[model samples]
Each structure stands twice: as structure tokens, then as C-alpha cells.
Target: MSEKATLKRSLGLWAIVALGLGYMTPTVVFDTFGIVAKQTNGVVPLAYIVALVVMLFTAISYGKMVRVFPSAGSAYTYTRETMGANAGFLVGWASLLDYLLLPLVNALIIRLYMESLFPEIPAWIWVVLYVAVVTFINVWSMGSTSGLNSLLVIFTVLLVVTFIVLASVQLYQGMGAGTLFTLNPIAHENVQAVAVLTGATIVCFSFIGFDAITMYTEEAANPNTVPRAIFLTVLIGGGIFFIAAYYTQALFPDLGVFHLLDDTLPEIGLYVGGKAFQLIFLAGAFAATVASGLASHASVSRLLYVMGRNGVLPRKAFGYVHPKFRTPAFNVIFVGAVSLLAIGPSLELISAVINFGALIAFTFVNLSVIAYFAFQQKRYKRPVDIFSYIIMPSIGAGFTGVLWYFLHADAFIGGIVWVSIGISYMLFLTKFFRTKMVDLDFDEADRPIGKEA
Candidate 1:
């Protein structure tokens, strides 16, 4: 028989890391700084620190899981292989909220940016244009997506460095904190543990892209490369967030300076640079949005493709990879169709909704490690294994659980509704648990390069 078409494996460590960074959208730190600063009482950097520590544990757990079960399904694949098909299906279903809505959020953000720049234009026009371009690029090939994403990421990084330099110059000239090296940015008299923790919960969303690296395992040059990419994506992305937050908080240690606390990037650009620089800042922001849109759009399509291949979703549409392009062309187009909804929903509403899936996926991935290693493999007898398999993931799970407590009520409402749909559909597929889900083949062809399946 002729072989089945598979995902082309062409991504190196740097290429994969670039996609992760693009997915994280490092420029998001500035967009969110003012809100988090207000929440933490001027300690935005400290809040990010807390978020980073929490994300690091989860990143490690993700790396551990990807090492054993290197596949494109990400949390869905890990949870399914370790837990059960039913559980995996549900996890993948929940993650659909996060993976799916993220691209929409990016499109929404672009609409807002365009409306700000050209109020005469209809917002829907911008949304359609942005989604069309991203969809086309993704459907073209993974290589094109990776190359474009890398360039955009590099541009954004340079912009970040420029902002830091300007902020430092202003700080030294006796601005907000009068100098860069001070605990004032990290702490002050009114600093409260609860407040910082609350801010941490909010900023935790900024680290969402790190876990996404696993979605590329099937495409990595070395499946083993995925683990390093996952950890480095988190470390490098977190470092950018921390350093940028430090300078920004030091420049304006209080919320009084920002007219729009919800989104301080514009005011930050105006204050630190000028009208000319504000345009540059907005351009950087646009690049970040486009980068994020491309990455998230690609990710959700692959997740859908994997589920489709396993019969959880429709086989013909979701599972089909184009023979010429070697891309999940149908799923990409489907996601583009969904991105049209960006015109209707407000960014805040969709943002909250995505968090529900992201945290759920993270929490379960941690549990999957314990399930697969400690129980399935009985690797907890050794002290090292106990620490790696038991203690660390437990901490990761606990941290995400705390964040769950702080999730918006709107998220609960939206998430519960989505989960209900997944349950109904899943029941129909399984005929009310009377039969097993069609087992997906992870044959020799899908394993990391240089490894036997």
C-alpha cells in the first residue's frame, strides 16, 4: 500500500524556538504593564517573576512529557497516552478554546490597532485582511511561516531594546525612580503579597506560548530538540518580560502617569520617545500581533489535524494535509473562517475565555507526567525520579490551580459552555462509552529524526 502523508519534519531548535517566541508575543509585556502595575501596586517586575517561576515548573513538565511522547497533539497527545482516550479527547477539546481563540484575539487586537490609526476604516475590513494574510502564509508551508515569524520576532526584539535604552536614559535623568538600580520597582512600602500573587495570576497568560512548543514536536529536526526548545522558549521569553518590566516600572513606578492603565504601550511610547517614536512603537505592536496570529493559527490547525487523524474530529477535512504544500490546508482555512468572529467579540471577553483552556491544559500536562512516569512506568522509587516525577509536577499543578482560583467569572461561564459541547460530541462519537476511540497510529514515521519508532 502507498504510505500515508505525514507532517514534514524540517524545524531546527532555533526555528522551533522562534515560533514559540512568536506565539508568546514578547511585546505583550508592555501592552499589559500598566494594568499589572496597578494590580501589584507598582511591582510589575515582581509579579512577572512569580509568574515565571510558576511557568518554569510547568515548562519542565512539558519537556519531560514531550521527551517520551513526541507528537503534534501536545497536551492532548500526552494526556491521552498516559491517562486514557476519553481524558485525552477532553483535554484536546478544552485546549481548542485556547488554541482556537488565540488567533482570533490577535485578529481582534489588529482591528483595534487599525481603528486607532485609521478611524475612517471599518474594523471588520482590518480583521478580514489580517486573517487572510496569515492564513495564506500558513497554508503555504511551515518553512515560510517560520522564516517570516523569525524576522518579525527579531524586529520586535530590537524595538524592545530601543525602548529599554530610552527608558534608562530617562531614568538616569531623574525620571520616575531617578535611577534604574533600586528595589522600588520590585517592591515598595505598600507592596502586598496577595496583590503581587494576583498580578502573577494575570501575567501568567503572557507565558502561554511556551507550552505550545510541543505542538511542533512532529515537525522538529530532532524530536529531542523539542524539550530544549520548550525550556528555552520559556526562559528566553520570561527574561524579555522581566527586563522590560523592570525598566518600565522604574520609569513610571505609579499608575498616575498612565492615562490608559488598561493598555500603557501607547502612552509609554509617547512619553519615552515622541510622536515619531509612537508610530514606531505601534508598528512594533502590529508586528507582534501578526507574529502571534501566524503562530496561534498554525498551532490550532495542527491540533485539529491530529484530532481529526485520530477520528475525534472529521477525518477527511481536519486530517487532510495537502500533497503539494504539505500543510493542513483545510484546517487552516477553517481557522481563518473562525477568525472572522474577531469582528464581533471584544478583545477582553475572548482573552478571558482563552485563559480557561490554557490553564486547564497546563494543569493536566503536569498530571500527565505523574500518571505516565510514576504510575505507568513506576519511576518514583529513586530519589531523583521522585523529585522529577512526583514533587516538581505537583508544584506545577498547585501553581496553576492557584491561578484557576483567580480566573474571571466570564471565563467560567464560557469554559463550562464549551466543555458541555465537547462532552455531548464526545458521547456521540463513543456511543455513550460502549466502544473505544479509534486508536491513532504513532508509527516509526512520526518519531523524532534519528530515532527508531
Candidate 2:
């Protein structure tokens, strides 16, 4: 194959971080702030604090695994390489759930926001338009995708800063909680563990964008840059959420007055900054979702391309990148088609399932770290080694497992059904363990364009 046929390595560290934040959609704090506040009884920031700490452990484990594998397919590749083909196959299939639903979920939310703004148009129109636009940009160019992500992330940051300033001003003028500094948003007279845990689960979704950056494993300029970018992405994105939640809750501490959990932030925007700011906030949110939806769409396509090329899936379609654009053409369109499902379900129900596959995938990533560093490499001699390899990953796995345990029964059963289908397919493909491995070349998967030397 010619050099032009391979994936390009134009993404630098900052570009990767920007891509992760773009996938994360920092403005999401505004969208979910009221819900978290209600769930936590006004201690939204504490939930984010817990979520941030939990994510750091997983981020550390992910950094370790990506350093070991240093290829595409994210958790799928890590678990497969460390555990076995069977484990890898199932994890990859599990990830398929996250990757497939994310774009659809984003589109659904985007459609809702649009419906709120312009009620006359049918919601399907918004979903179709967003799916088409984002799909076209992704298929057209990787540079364009990252570039758009950078712009959107920057705009979101600016909008967040503006909201903070406006909310702070309002608080100083004796509005809402009438104070900027208060333990009320982090902890109160009667903070409950169950409430915090529920909020933590919702906030966990906010941090998964860093993990999604692993989809660009083969495309990063330096593979080592990936781990650093992942850590920074989580911290930076979490910081935004922390700050946003703190002020938003401080501005509107009363959850009973929120009336509409789905559109609470917009109501706050109107209360604190008036109708103009409310519209601007809505625009910022819509933009944030687009950035998120676009990055997620790109990630899932790469996943299918890698698995398809490896014979874990159909080779002719998902495996085939466009000759001119060098993008996963078929997988791109397929994910867009699946986004149509967003139109049927209640957005909240679909959103519940998002965390299921993601949390499971994360728990295994922690185990992958233990499998690689402690068992495979036998590097548990030193205190640092034992801590990083065994202790941290163990904590991460246990924490993520707890979150998975608490997921809605619908998501729990749905996840089981999804995994069973993967297991069944694997059994059929491998003939009950007769074929041990798929012919996947992680090196060939990441083989850069300028490797003549």
C-alpha cells in the first residue's frame, strides 16, 4: 500500500487535548448542573470532586495501557493484548455500545435544544441535519475535524467564563444563594452518600471524553504524547465542570424552583443574565454538542475500521477507508444511520445506558494495567511499581465497578444482552476457541504515512 493510504499523524499534543475536550463538551456542566444539584441536594461540586479523583485513577491506568499497546481500539486493544483474544473481543464489542450510542445521544440532546429554541420545526429535522453535517465533516478531513474541535472548545470555555462572571455578579447582588463562597455547593448540613454517588455517576459521563481520545491512538504525532494529553484532558475538563457547577449551584441553590430538570440551566441563564444570555447559552450548548458528536463519530469509525480490518468484523465495508480522504467511509455513514434511533427513546433513558458500557470498559482498563505491569512484566518489586501497577488500578477497577453496579436495571440488563450477543458472535467466529486470535496488526493499523526509512 502507498503512504497516502495510511492514517495521517498530524495531531500534536495540544491538538489531542483539544480533541478530548471537544469530545467532552465542557459546557455540559451547564446542561446537567441543575440535575446534579437536585441529586446531591445542592452539593454538585463535591460530586465532581469525587468523580475527578475516580477518573484520575482510570486515566492513569489508561495511560499505562496506551503506552503498552500504543495503537487504536482503546480498551479493546488493551484488554485483548493483556488478557486474551476472547477478552479483547468482548471488550471491543462492549465498547461498540458506548461508541454507537454517544453520537446518537448527543444528536438527541441537540435536537431537544433546537426544539426549545424553534418549536415549529420537527425534531427529526434537527437530528438528521446534525448527523449529516457532522458526518460530512468527519468523512471530508481529519484536519477539519480537529480544527473544528479546537474552535468549539475555545468557544465553550469563553461561554463558561462568561456564565461564571455573570453568575458571580448576580450572587454579589443578593440573588439565589446571595454568596459566591459557600460550603453549601460542596457539602451541606445533611449531605447524603447515595445522593453524591448518584451525582458521581452522572458526572462520570463528563470525563469519558479523555478515554475517547484513545481512538486516535494511531494518529497522534508521538505516541508518548497520548498519556500526557489524556491526563491533562481529564484534569482540565474536570476543572471546568467543577468551577461551573460550583457557581451555577451557588446561583440557584433551590432545586425545587428549577421546575424543569432538563432545561434548568437555560432557566438560570434567564434568571441571572436575562433572555439574551439564555439564547447565547443555548447556542453555546448546541455548539458543544456538535463538537462532541463529531469527535465521537470519528472515534467509533476508527474502532470499526480496526476491528473490521482484523477480521473481527466484515473486511470489505468497515475495513475500507476512502482512497482519497483516507477516512473510514462506511463506518462513518453507519454510525450516522444509527443516530436515527435517538428520535424514538426518551433522552434520559438512552443517557442512562451511556455510562453502562463505558464504566465496564474502564474497569477492565484498570485490570489491564494490573495484568501488564504486575503479572506480565513482574514489576511489583518497588513501592512505586506496586502502587502504580497494583494499587491504583485496583482502586480504579473497584470504583468503576461500584458505579456499574448502581446503574439503572434497564441499562444493566441491556448491557448483559449486548455482551451476550458479542459472546455468541465470538463463539461462532472462533469456533469455540479453535481459532485463538484475529489477524490484527496493531503496527499495520498505526503504520504512519512517512515510514520509508
Candidate 3:
């Protein structure tokens, strides 16, 4: 519990990428496919394509910002450095809804999986055990957490590949669509603009974790590894989502194929690969939750550590790292404790508000690029500079802004309430806006590995 301790720099590019994929939870494509297909009128792949494009733009902005401010704080650091302390603190606060609750979301999903399989066991038992294991692994060491996460991600990816192969064979043998190549999955005569946009907003949830890669900047083997990892994570993860959505949408051209429209993974598994494969597939889904839980749990703890070290939160509690483990032990355990709330809320209710904070953070990161490069550095004088610093980030901002417009009203309300709380806390912390906020020592935080005392 030493304030002098810092996160160990033990992650390479592949380790960081695996963490990102785990956080994204590739199997989520199946769980959400039925709902998005229904919402998009069977054009789930098209919605995913739109979401991938939108996220790619934001990913580019994230890469650019990380090069300038390569700290574990991620969007919070970028926004604060370029924009101001107040905006950065608020963005970080709003981001807690997305970051903090994600571990609980994973816990909630695992409980659903367990209760479905073992109907006799109490649900809270699974949540407690799952949270405890994830928290302990993260608290133990970053290396072990990454190793376990990598294995889980690899397993889930293999299962997804198997499902696609089975679905392809079924389609070739005169199944739902009877062929692999078709425009129906992307568009048809009945597709509406509003519906696709709404579906895009929903599918954007699958793309959320790509940015979480930025949280490992301080732990990366090289400063440059982070940007490359961010782009790779988004493109690779997006490709998986797109391909899965296409094949799954083709296999079941209509919602009528699924008995449970909102939750179709089990039914899809039962249909595509039958009972034995369904058993294996369900196991993969559970693996995905564990992988995701570890990644999200670690990511939020780092974010909390950065904020705590900066005195935005309490310096002693949130900022302390275990001297031997070199992990933010207090923040990790604190997040695990809060994750116990997973027992009360339904997944649908939590899912509703998750996107609110993500879009807010996404929108600000995009704008932060323009604010820092174009306005602050005057980088817009040249054509290439204009494209990189101005036009690109503008498009990224506009795209996320559109998603914000299409966001559920419930998300808007929840986000506003959270922001109001953050505002009140900020007012009290700053003594009614009279005092200057405490600043982080970037030189000490990002010093080269050999330079650290």
C-alpha cells in the first residue's frame, strides 16, 4: 500500500491486444445478434459495418492522443491535458458508468449463464465467486491476468470460428439463405435509415473495449506500441464482429428462427451445431465473461489509480499500489466490492445506460485531438495537418455525436444525473471554483523504465 509504487511495465503489444479483445468479449456478437437483427429489420451486418467505421475513426483519434499523452488515464488524460481539468474530471466521472459497471455487467452475465445451467444454485453465489476470482487474479499480477485473458480470448475466438464453419456448411446444404454471398444481410428493400442508425448505436457496444487499450499505455513495453495496439485491436475486433454478424444473420434470415429473440446465443448454438456443440458453445460464452471481467476490472482500476494519484479522488485510498505486486490493489478490491451490485439489476437495465458514458468519452476524445493539435499547436496550416488534425477528428466527433443523438432517453437521463453528481463533487473539491486543481507530474509518471528511481 505504498504511494511510491507504480504499475509495472510488463505488457507487450500482443498482451495489450489480448486484453482489448477480452474486454470486447467476441461472443457478444451472438448474444446481441438477435436483438440487433430485429431492430435493424434483419440487416445486422450492415449495422455492424456502420459501427466499425465509426469506431475506426475514433480509434484513430485515440492513437493520435496516446502519442501525445501516454498515460494510463486514457481519455481522461487526453481531455484534461488539451481541454482543462474540469472537463477532464467530468469526462472521467461520466466514464465510470461505462468502466466501473462493466465488471458488474460481466458478473451479471456470468450469473445468468450459471443460473440457466444450474437452476438450483442461488445467483448471488456465482456473482460473489466470479468477482472474487477476477479481483484476486488482477490484484496478484498483470502478467498472470494477461496470460489467463489471452487464453480465454483464444478459446472464444476458436469457438466463434467453429460456429461460422458449421453455419457455412449448413447454408451450403440448402439451409436458411442457401448461399454465402447475398445482399440481404446488409440491405434489402425494407431497410430504413433510422432503424440502421439505431442498430448502429446498439452494436457500438461491441466496439467499446478497443479504446480501453489506451489504459495500458504506461504498462506497454514501448511508448509506440500503444498506438499500433489500439488500431490493431479495433480493426481485428471489428472484423470478427462483422464476419460473425454476416453469417449469423444469413443463417436465420428472420427473427422467427429464434424462440428467444433478445437472447439468441443458446438457440443459435442449438440450431447451428446441435446439442453437443451447444454445450461447448455455452462454455465459451462463460469463458468470455471471465476474460472480459478481468480486462474491465484491470482497466477501471488503472483509471482510478491515475485519478487518485492526481488527487481528483482521495490520494491515499484510490491511488495506492501494493508494494510487492505493483498493482493498484486498493482500487481493484474496491471495484470488486462494488461489483456485488450485480445481483439486483437486470442486464437489460444496466445495458441501457452503458453506452451513455462511452459515447460521452468517445465524443470528447475526438474533440480533444482538434483542440490540442489544430487549435493549440496550430497544426492546421498544411493540407496533411488539416486532414489529420482537423477533418478526421471532426468526422469522428460528428459520427459519435450522431450516435449520441440516437442514444436511448434513459441513457441521457442516467448520464446527466451522473454528471450532476460529478459537478457537485467538483464544486466542493475546488471550493466553488476558486482554487486551481492539482496537476499530475507527467515527467515522473511517464519517465523511461531505466530512469525511474
Candidate 4:
């Protein structure tokens, strides 16, 4: 039977932006800096700025590429078109881990927060229930998920902004003994470049899902609106996260609050304002985590749908779309089920596996941007210049490489195991499945004359 026509482009620019930010905001404000502080000793905001700069170049490349190839596959499409089918498939396989692990991490986090309130319910039950609900939301209709995501995003943004403003006011009023700004809190007196780069990696992980918007290109009202939304989402999301980290450091100069990383609810309320602030922060954190899970389910389902359409999987089952709802019905449920099963093992272990996949995907994305620009210049004589094509990617890869080095040994081992699984799967597809591969047209669009090469 023929597949249904591709999803209609119904999502507006603002909703698309909210969808991406909603996925990103929850963890960055509350969880990300805590990791950076552990590595850099409270200079987490500095690490955030550093990671933002590295990510900016990649974001620029992604912005340019998305306009030319407005498909649901994202980097999977770009790498395939410019490089080859094998390269694209590899990226797609790696990204599968990234998207799959995000929902698991989000659900686990939400489970932790919910346990604080409910206390009686088992964490595993909450994890299963959270994934089930999010999967249902994803399978119902894209329009419905987009609407809910928009509403949650508004609440997330407001809570984050309020926390920032309140923290800033308290610092200005000298309400606490913490320093307004000081490098003194950093653990090492003689900070090495490696340490900074390592800290930036952990910080950048928090910013991972900001690009999930690209997965919705096929469903966006205007494809051109995506590039602007991507840049804006990264800027606004990264900026808010950076500011939040700075204020957090200023309020609690010692960074002791972050020691609660292993703690369930992470007493951010006390550090930010007090009891009232804590409750508000907890509510916002929960909303953000749930939103992230919803967004993750949405994006991963699309990826699987697209991959199935391309004949890389059991197309009959994986490619199935909802007859009435017109969504990726099977893929949505598949991801949610996998994520739910994952939460039972160990939260920290799950987090490590997800981070490993994310870092690898990030590394490839940065490299793909460089490779794409280089291919463009070589094939079409397009003048992208050395700075964008060479310098930026080199710096991004360098920084990210260092960050990967500092990851826990267990995370590294888990990442290796995951990739090995992907490699084995790809080998089976080529041998037994013998899937036909298609060549992509990356040079369809022309560069403006006299542009820098």
C-alpha cells in the first residue's frame, strides 16, 4: 500500500520556536550549569558563553542548509546529500540514540520531581506513566502536541525570567554574602584551556534539543521561517541559560547547591529566593521536563517515520502512520516504550548513555557543517570563506573533543557499546535487508554571485 502524503505544513513560526525552546529550557536552567560547576568550579556561565560561541557557527551552517533542504531528516539529509548514503545513515543511526535517550532522561527527571510531591508512588511507575502519557499525546495529532507545547513554553519562559530577575535583584540589593561576580569560586587557580573546553561540553549538552525544531520542517507553515527560529531559539535559550547560571553563581558563590546534583529536587528555590521561589521553580521544572519529553517524542517519531519511508527499517510497521490522525503512529509508540523500559535501570546510567550519544551527534553535526561548506565550495564554486567553512568547525570540534574526553569512563564505554550496536545493525541492513539507497541533490540551490568563497 502507498504511504500517506507527507504531513501538512500547519505549524506557524512562533509555535515552532516554542516547540524547540520548550524542549531545551527545562534542563538547561536547572540541571546543566550544575554539571559545568562540577567541572569548572562555579564558573559555569563562562563555560556556557564559550559553548554558545562554538555552537553559533554550527547553528549558522544549519540555518543555511535547512533553507536549501527543507526535509524532516535534518543532518541525516544534509550529510547524505553532500557526502554519501553511508555517511547519512551513520549520522541517522547516531542521532537515533540522541533523540531516544532524551525522552528517557526527561521522563526520569520528571519522575524524580514527581516523587518529591507524591513520595509514595514508585519512581519506576512515574517513569512508565510519564512516557505513556507523552506517547499518547504524540500519537494523537501534531497540532495538539504543538498547542500544548506552546502553552507550556510560555509558562517555562515566564518562570525562568522571573527567577533571573529575582536573583539579579537580590544580588544588587546585597541581600546575601555572595559575590556579584568573581572567578575566585572556580576550583583551579590556574585554569587550563582543556578544563574550560571540558566544562563547555557538559554545558553544551544542556543546549542539545534546541535544534529539534528542524525535525518539523515538513510541518512548518513556511519552511523559510525555520532558519530564523533556529537562530532565535539558540540565542534566547542559550542566553537565558547563561544568565541563570551567572545569577546562580552570584547568589551562592560557593556552588554548594550544585552538590545536590544527585539530590532529587535540587533545592534551587533556596538558592534563588526562598520557600516560595522554590515551589515556583519546582513547578516550572516539572513543566519543562514534561515538555521536553513531549518534544522528544514528537521529533524521534518523525525521524523514525522518515527513516522507515527510506526503507532502512521494517517499512510496513515502522513507516505506519495514523489513518485518522495523520501522525507517525507506530514510531511514536515504539520510542515511548523503549524510553519507559530504560528508566528502570538507573537514572545516572541513563543520563550518561544519553549524554554520550548527544556528544557524538554534536561532534558530527559540527563536522558536517564544515564538510558541507567545503563540498559547496569545491562542487559549485560557492564562496563560503575559510572562517565559516574551516575555522569555526575546527574550533567546535576541538572544544567538543575535549569535553568528550572528560566524560565519565562509564559513559565513554556505554557510548562505544551503543555505536557498536548501530554498526552491527547497519551491517545487517546492507547484507540481509539489501536496502536500495538513493542519491540526494544538495546543489539544487545557487549561491549569490560575488559571495565570499
lDDT of 1 by residue, 1-453 (tens): 555556688999999999889889988888778778877899999989988988889899999987887654377778889999889888878888888888888888788777666779888999989999999998896544688878888998999999999998999999888987999988789999888877787787788888767767788888988888988999999999999999999998767877656557777888898889889999999888876787678767776776677677788998788877878899999999999899987554676688788888889989999999999999988999999999999999999888777776788899999999998988888799887765643222242221222
Ranking by TM-score: 2, 3, 1, 4
- lDDT of each residue in 32-89, candidate 4, tens digit only: 4455566666676777787787666567667767776777436666777666777777
TM-score of each: 0.88, 0.90, 0.89, 0.83
Which sections of candidate 4 miss by over 4 Å? Answer: 1-15, 145-148, 169-192, 218-222, 255-259, 263-266, 321-329, 341-349, 376-384, 432-453
Query: Which ten-residue region of model 2 has the weakest summed lDDT?
Result: 444-453
RMSD of each: 3.8, 3.0, 3.6, 6.4
- Candidate number with greatest lDDT: 3
Q: On lDDT, who's better, 1 or 4?
A: 1
Show the lowest summed lDDT stretch of 10 residues, model 1: 443-452
lDDT of each: 0.82, 0.80, 0.83, 0.68
Sort by lDDT, top down from the best: 3, 1, 2, 4
Please, what are the lDDT tens digits per residue for candidate 3 over residues 1-453?
334446788999999999899889999888778778888899999998888888989999999998887774367778888889888878878878888888988898787767656769998999999999998998997544688888888998999999999999999997889998988999899999888988888888888888878767788888699888988999999999999999998999978866656457877888999989988998899878776787678767876886677777898998788887888899999999989999877664566578888888899999999999998999988999999999999999999989878876777888789889988988888898998666643222442221234
The parts of candidate 3 lying over 4 Å away from their true place are 1-15, 120-122, 136-148, 218-222, 257-259, 315-330, 440-453
Off by over 4 Å in 2: 1-12, 139-148, 215-222, 320-327, 440-453
Give the distance in Å from residue 53's predicted Cα in candidate 2 to where it truly belongs.
0.8
